[model samples]
Target: MQYTGASIRKTAAHFNIPSFKAVSQWERIYYEQGKDALFKEQRGRTSKMGTKRPKKPKTNIETNEDLLAQVQRLRMENEYLKKLNALIQKRERSEKSTK
Candidate 1:
């Protein structure tokens, strides 16, 4: 089951399992962590700490329309913020020139 260097040579000699490195990896895992660790159970990128899971998409038609309107409102807010930031920078530069 657990294949070491000695085991790899023995297995290769007797049974012809070609990858010694792969066999050695299996051996190390089995010896150190046991069999359950070898199985691939978890899938996809793990969520970061303190970050909430993304909300599921709304299936209801009314809810989807509401969300779309909210998204447009948020986009307008972002554009307003950008223009405000540019105005503030222009003011800062003007003040610096005056001084």
Candidate 2:
């Protein structure tokens, strides 16, 4: 209420608010609508279009070994790409030196 023309930072600090942006929004709402609007629910609707579908759980068929193998394969591919990039950069440097 003391923030009629006062800075938002000072108001937030006076109230020990983590984010000054919240104070800025509250001030905007207070001016536009009223102080009662601040007491109302500020959260938006959870779902407006339709109800959300829950995620399906993986079956027991997905074993730990299969997950580990997949991770190893991805790591090998990432290492191969890094080595290939280094070789390409080396070749480019050599070409530049020759020019």
Residues 2-92, candidate 2: write the lDDT tens digits: 6376788988988999899999999899999998898998697666677679978866667889999999999999999999999999999
Task: Quote the lDDT for 24 in model 1.
Answer: 75
Tens digits of per-residue lDDT for model 1 on 2-90? 33435576766565778777667776777798888778555677877787889998776577788999999999999999999999999
Cα deviation in Å at residue 52, candidate 2?
Answer: 14
lDDT of 2 at 34: 94
- TM per candidate comes to 0.38, 0.41
Q: Score residue 23 of candidate 1 by CA lDDT.
A: 69
